[model samples]
Target: MPVISPNTNYIRPSPYRSAAPPRSPGPTPEEPLPQPPPVVLDDSKESTHEPCWALDAIRYSTIVGAFSLTSADLKLLKKVPRGDYEDDDHHDRRITRTQSQILSRHGQRIDFGFGSSGRLKHRGMPMYALANAPEQELYRNMSSGGTAVMKPFSLRQIRVRFLWPLPRGEEPSHEAYDEWVRVDPLYTRVQLAMAVARVFYRFVEANRLYLSQYHDYPWRLRPDVFYRVWLLGLERVDTNVFVADLKYVKDYPNE
Candidate 1:
């Protein structure tokens, strides 16, 4: 055995140092990997973000009913990020990004941490966390309603789980505070997607037309034109003239 000196430097081999020669390539092309069909989960695998079909019918009916009761033309409200805690009493506390990422919702938040640490790490317990329960309008973790609307259900918990909570302490607009818990962005977006699917299923079930008859038709040709606009499932959006004509409704009271 050679005695190695403590001060001697050792040279590391190059990463690709194998001395073997490359083999000749085969002429045939490789087969492409197959893609999987999309999955739609049922209630057994439901998450807090989703409402069941029966529940959705009841809830959506209530909301639509409430809108109908307004004698004057109701200007539909615009959705904005509401996951902020300072604006509402839902979030238990003001939370760090890591903590809020756990529950993955856009609503009046609890500022509760979601991950394994299961704590309100930096900001301490949110004021809402100490509250016995949230206000009636504020939704808790439940997807029981969508079931009634006959909506398409996809597994979104995985995506939602890692999503960060809304930024705390947004600018106070009197208009913003009044509707704090009315229309949550994430839930509305998801609900809209379901509404679109429901129309398609209705068309098929009613035998108004075969899917092949309108397979290539634009989604515009579908039933209940308004529901198509539900649950955009995205944030920080702008609508240009090319997108959709802006109809100015009398400015909403909150605005």
Candidate 2:
């Protein structure tokens, strides 16, 4: 081989010269980095937010039973009226939109993330992770003369745990464990109505109703309806109209 001078400017030729030009590197900072769209989570699988009318639903149900429910409530429990959705210019667009969404997903399997009896999975979590238990009431044990404390069997327990502590001093004699555990009929009835409202909402959500439809439904899933209205950016004017018009009874505090 001929001796090559180290000072020569000869460059080694690349075999890829005949190949296609290399791809451009990613966009530079000056080019705004071609920002990707923000990630949006699909809340269609679960309820985006609990309803706003839950307390009112409970309060009213306790007083008048089925009479407390509204036309929308009945529709949710049974079937949506043809006129409710047929009108494009319906006064309440929220309802119309919700109905449209439900119709769009006429057939699909829905997983509510909980069992049919409304019990949530414990998965080794503390009871606090579960839904809050309902308030306990005192029931008079006519024979024992000692008042029995009881509460509704809530779907919110982490396990089959009794939240209420048994009486310390006097244990009322009963033929069965459930005898003293018997809850107020009115309370149980209201709780069942609340359960119905929840199931119905899940049905609507499974059918692809807008996640925002949580508020549009007649019943509120959480107690803070007004707060949710603000958080969801829903107009108070519309929400005001959605409020159930049952006369308030001072005796039954909206507790």
Candidate 3:
């Protein structure tokens, strides 16, 4: 029985003792991170600054006729400087308020018919030509004694002055004062010239109807002729920068 038991005593191996597979080597140390390119700052020299007040004046004059300008008109025409005004002590606001008051006054004056008074007076020139044709010698046969000497009608001259006030209580060396003094006149003149041109054009248009009534009166209604005459007179006048001699012509008829 002992021999039989020994023959049957064989041992079984455990299944839970299996070995693990090896892992891949960790990634080789990554190449050092690439450095970024250096940034370059510009160190160029700045150009010299030039004063703009005079340049602005010349520009204003070329586009707009040289004429007397109001404070409000000048303010409208001025090229306002660019900058932050939050810390400007409200000077810009004060000036704007003052300009508004002046504009209000101007509008009030216009409402009282003062704006068109001169225009109306000038518009009556055609009627004047009709009444005083013989005395004024406006036509070839127009004369007190039936003279036939050909002559043209005289056009009324409109002269506009360029007037603006310089700054007071400020030294000439101050930039603000210099700008105010130079820019104000320039802007005023430009605005005034525009205003004059508008008025003159309106006057011509209105007189066109009356001037057409007298077709036999030698002088015909020609806006181009009137404009040319005006330009000629303006160039001749030294005191007035804006002058127009609006005359009727015999060559052209109203369209």
Q: Pick the candidate with the highest lDDT.
A: 3
Q: Which pairs in model 3 have colliding backbones?
A: 68-161, 220-249, 230-245
Q: Rank the candidates by TM-score, best first.
A: 3, 2, 1
C-alpha local distance difference test of each model:
0.23, 0.21, 0.24
For candidate 1, the per-residue lDDT at 211 reads 18
TM value for model 3: 0.21
User: Comparing candidate 2 with candidate 3, which one achieves the higher TM-score?
Assistant: 3
What CA root-mean-square deviation does each model show from the true structure?
Answer: 26.3, 29.0, 41.8
Give every collision pair in model 2. 51-220, 51-221, 52-220, 53-220, 54-220
Residue-level lDDT of model 3, residues 59-143, one tens digit each, is: 2222121123233323332211211123323122112223324434211110000112322212112212222123223232111
Over 141-253, each residue of candidate 2 has an lDDT whose tens digit, in order, gives 01111221112212121110000111122122100100001123233322322222332222222222212234433322222221111000001112101111111121222
Q: Tell me the spans in candidate 2 whose CA falls farther than 4 Å from its real position.
A: 1-187, 208-255
Residue 105 error, candidate 3, Å? 30
Model 1 lDDT per residue over 65-143, tens place: 2222232422232222223334443333322344334534443221221112221111111111112112232122212
- On the 0 to 100 scale, the lDDT of residue 250 in model 1 is 18
Q: Among all windows of ten consecutive residues in candidate 3, which has the lowest summed lDDT? A: 173-182
- Candidate 1 off by > 4 Å: 1-80, 83-192, 195-233, 236-255
**Each model's backbone clash number:** 29, 5, 3
Q: For this target, which candidate reaches the highest TM-score against the unseen true structure?
A: 3
TM-score of every model? Answer: 0.16, 0.17, 0.21
